[model samples]
Target: MDQPFRHIIALAALALPAFATNARAEEAALIDGGKLLLTNGVTTIEGASGGGLASWATIAGRGTDRGIGLSTHVTLIELPDYGWQSHGVALGLANRLELSYARQNFDTRDVGTALGLGKGYRLNQDVFGAKLRIAGDVVYGEPLLPQISVGVEYKRNRDAPVALTVGANAAKGADFTLSATKLFLSHSVLVNATARLTKANQAGLLGFGSNGNDNHSLQFEGSIAYQLSRRAVIGAEYRSKPDNLAIAKEDDWLDLFAAYALTRNLTLTAAYVDLGSIATFDKQRGGLLSAQLAF
Candidate 1:
């Protein structure tokens, strides 16, 4: 198997052991799984809990205000000229603090050959993220109040040499995000909006910034969802990306997705995504599939 797939399998193996270790005398108190179905939000490409393509203000697990929770996910995206894969794990503490890790591998099929990087070249990156819920609640706060969160993500590109060769100023960078999310039970609707400060190019797959333009810029991520039932939701997301690389033009991303809870602990999501352009390849669109398990 490929190294990245092996790493994912190893990470999956740790989940059961870790959960078992925590299921001691205080198991009931720690793993209550009290949150409503689908309220925890699905995992993002960066591994934080949110919409399929955008980050939301919701926390990561099914834990309530007093319990701890764990979640893991694997996501795949297939494009005409590229393929994407990511897997990660997350820990939620008392539904207030969240920590996550995700590794993304972008496969540059024939496009790599055109770019003189050999066919099937792959770019890999690791993302480490942390989020803190500052105030309010996603489902129970005042009608006008929404859940608010602040988060930070530090990304490291594995192919630093390639990144630098593409005129990127650095192979690593950090991003900050402020998000707000609310679920209106009466209307069966969920809404989210996030503002991000970043300088990463192509979501950091190509690199961070460029010598000519190396400043962070404000970006936006918005989502609106309608709950079809207690365990199902359909939503659309829009994420604006910065064009910080002079070598290539980047475009915003959009997706229409549906998520369903197959079981209390397992949720499945599918989406059609439009990732405008990547490395000068325009009209890059694809389908996304993801599965998340939480407890």
Candidate 2:
């Protein structure tokens, strides 16, 4: 790992043990899985809670205001020229704070050989994230107030050499996001909007910004969903991303997704995604499937 990445991990390591000890001492008082179904939202690509392509203001897990909860998920994506898989774990505290970690692998497949990087080459990344709910509630409290949150994600690219060779300025960077979300009980609809500041290329799979474009840019993500039943929802999401690398012309991502709760603790999500172009290859559309377990 790079020096900065090592420092980030070490800091988390030092704080986690102490927090875990305290949490264990109050385990009985802390864990109460009482949130309503699907209100906590599904896991996003980077492991935060929301739609597959966008993050929402809702926290992770099915925890109530006075409880702690855990969630885990695995996601897979199949594209014409690439393959993607990611898995992660998240912790929600008092339905106000969330901490998450995810690992992503992007397989280049035949495109790797065409680019002279050998067939089946892969790019890997690790994302560490934290979010704090600042106000309101998604399904309760003031009807139009909405839930608001601020978050940050630090991403580390595992293939630093390749990233540098491709003109990326750094292999590690951070993204800051602000989100607002609301659920209208009368209409059975949920809406969310998020603003992000980032310079990552392909969400840091290929790396951060190119040498020529190292500045972070503002982006937007929006989602709208309708509740079909108590346990099922269909949604659509659109996410704009920064095109910071000169070698690859990146594009915005959009998806139409459906999620169903099989049980109080398990939910499955499926989506048809259009990722646009990636690394000079066009029409990189695909299907995404994910499974999440929460308590």
Candidate 3:
């Protein structure tokens, strides 16, 4: 394990009991059979309950069947010329709301040397998020209404001077999102749509905005998943982004991913990611792996 990821795992291990406290009534049973498998989706890179690169309509918790679901995840992505890692914890309260916090580290790799920053300069960001499942259910909705959620993420970038030196406008920003998810159980397929408003560049990892333009833009994220079994899923996702920074035009992100429940409390995820370009690096294609523990 990497240093940052290991540190986060330690914290999560200590916090796990707190997140699972509400479920003591069921924990004693040791066999959580009532809660259907794979209902609590995998943790997104931003620490929200979602797909690999996009937020899903489903809440973080298991469902009404389970009390509280707390999850911790570590994601690492290796691009052709860039490296990124993020770790976070998400807590779901009664499957109705979610709270998440994440720390992201972006290794500039060769870009750092080109910019005279260092051989492998890193940009660190802290993100805090909250989400509310306002209506419907992803799996058990009646009359075909989709599950809906509203969310917000506040991002704080640590290296503002570097971003501004490179022609960025601001360093901190928040994104507001709305998501709707539906499950066609009979067909074994799931679909979701999400809308986000933001002015952040590179999802706030490259700062908030650039001097040329700083207006908040509406972005879209869509996902489709096919269930292969009770504990496994395959999905594809696309997330649009704003080209707010003049230093480097931003591009949309896409990924194909899989999530599997190894146990009621453990889930694993793997993905192939494509982030067109950043700063000056092009064809940023890579893979992502994440492990989640929830109860």
| Candidate maximizing lDDT | 2
* Superposition error at 141 for model 3 (Å): 2.5
Query: How does candidate 1 fare on TM-score?
Result: 0.91
With a 3 Å backbone cut-off (N, CA, C), the pairs that clash in candidate 1 are none
Give the clash total for candidate 2.
Answer: 0
lDDT of each: 0.88, 0.89, 0.81
Off by over 4 Å in 1: 1-28
Model 3, 237-256: lDDT tens digits are 99999987666867899999
lDDT of 3 at 237: 96
Q: Give the number of the best model, judged by TM-score.
A: 2
Candidate 2 off by > 4 Å: 1-29
Q: How many clashes (backbone N, Cα, C below 3 Å) per candidate?
A: 0, 0, 1
lDDT of 1 by residue, 107-212 (tens): 9999999988999999999998878777889999799899998887888899998899888999988788899999999999999999999998888998999988
lDDT of 2 by residue, 147-239 (tens): 998888889899999888887999999888899999998999999999999999999988899888889999999999999999999999999
Error of 2 at 37 (Å): 0.4
Q: What TM-score fits each model?
A: 0.91, 0.91, 0.87
Whole-model lDDT, model 1: 0.88
